[model samples]
Target: MSIKIYGDPGSGSLRRITSAAAVMGVEIERVNIDLFKGESHTPEYLELNPHGLSPVMVDGDFVLYESSAINLYLAEKAGSDLAGTTTRERYEILQWMFWSGEQWRVFATLTFDEVLAKRFMGKPADESIVNLAAAKLRAGASVLDAHLAKHDYIVGDRLTLVDFDIAGPFSQNERTKIPLNEFPNLVAWQQRLLETVPAWADTKREVDVRIDTALEAAGIKL
Candidate 1:
């Protein structure tokens, strides 16, 4: 079974799906879509994904978009322990996945647009908008930090697709200077994730470099 993943480096969606595949011991043929140059908007790419989003997954005749969806699909395909073995476990995994997408992703996108896009891509930055986004982002992190304090992983004791799904956006928060120090549990959780996940550790340096460049361009000192 051949799987293809199209994404730009350092995108949270890319990290989520790729890390999921790695954890499942699945090898995906990567197709790099250059978001830096609007490659995702090209006619050919748009034909594949009308939304023009990165982290598109193509398996045989089936094609899917959205990072969370891709991660779940890979986990299901691989029967990875992360997908959960029971009905309740599956529900918990889905719950955290939804939380990550609805809550964390919204805040991260706002910051990316208000800060990184403005600074690095020469777009306009709205100070009020970013401040609001920062507030919401911190609020969400607080909740996550509280939950993580009691649990080693998002769903129960073992790592699941939930952990992989949330890690991408949460890790990006550090890059955006969201002040994770306020959430000590989250800081420790991220460190533990990096230590346990080989894929995350392998990509850490590259991810940090990319985030640093973007943050620096935005005048956000790490």
Candidate 2:
């Protein structure tokens, strides 16, 4: 049986898992969960993921939550090298995934939610919150930029699950008002991935279209 994923199409976490599955040649059945309508808080979704987060994966009797973990699971299931070929490589990819979730996602989410996501929810951006989060995001971007300067991909020369995991948020940089121009290496790395990685490029295109439509419906101009 094909894996089934429950999430809204516009969800960044959802996009991560879908992008990974795409590159790994894993087919998934996407089940929409309208988070804006509080669908995720329902008992059924909560049963699958107590945290009520998007991108819950179910494969037969097995169930999994957390987008990063789902992506890793899909990679292994598909026998894809993205999970890493060697022990050290797998751990290194894991390290980056952990960092992306713990460190990068924190600031990125805050900035995006405040600057753009709030508007979609019929709320105004919190200037104070946006300022604080933007500052932190810039600092985090600096660290990533430095790393990208030494290597093309997050882990090594080749793309890995961690790259898809981390790049999901960056795809929304423009909407979130992230200053990619300040970090040349980071910008170049993102461009390289978009141009070279068909899975990510395709997923990002679809995601952008969905978000843009939502923004338009929300009466948000940009």
Candidate 3:
């Protein structure tokens, strides 16, 4: 069984998938797609992923998209501890995975596009949009912070798919200049995640370097 992952290094989805593969001790063949050049939107790529997104996974005849879904698939396939063994554990993993995708991704992407992209990448920033995105992100962070206050990991004590799913978007706070002090619990949770999952911290460093390289190549002062 061979696994191929098509994604750009700087993409959040790519970081998540790569981190999952690392944790699962799986070797993945990476096909880098140039986002700025619109390679992902090309006809052939579109045929593989109708959504034209990064981090598409092809495992033998099975093809999948969505970063979280890819991580879950890889974890299950590897029979790693990242995927819970029991039904209850699986459900708990799914719960946090959903929360990460819906809550964290939504706000992080919005704020990144509105504020960070403009400030760091030289994109135009609309004050109104930035303000709105900031408010939404803060609200979402508060939710995660509250939940994290009582739990070390997203799903009870052990690190599972829930923790993997949120790592990418959560790491964005550092680069995107989103303050974590307001969400102390979330900040603490992230630190603990980094400590427990060293691969996550490594992936974060790689992702940061990749993004900086991409921006530098584009002549954007980030």
Candidates arranged by lDDT, highest first: 2, 1, 3
Summarize candidate 1's per-residue lDDT along 26-144 as a digit string, tens digits. 98998887676789899988977999888798999998998888887887788787888899998888888888788877777878767666666566778888788878878888998
lDDT of 3 by residue, 85-174 (tens): 888888888887887777767776777777555555456877776677677778878887888988898775778766767656666666
lDDT for each candidate structure = 0.79, 0.83, 0.78
Predict model 3's lDDT versus the native. Answer: 0.78
Report how far residue 220 has shifted in candidate 3, in Å.
3.3
Residue 138 of model 2, lDDT score: 77
After superposition, the stretches of candidate 3 with alpha carbons farther than 4 Å from their true spots are 116-122
Best by TM-score: 2
- Candidate 2 weakest ten by summed lDDT: 172-181
Candidate order (TM-score): 2, 1, 3
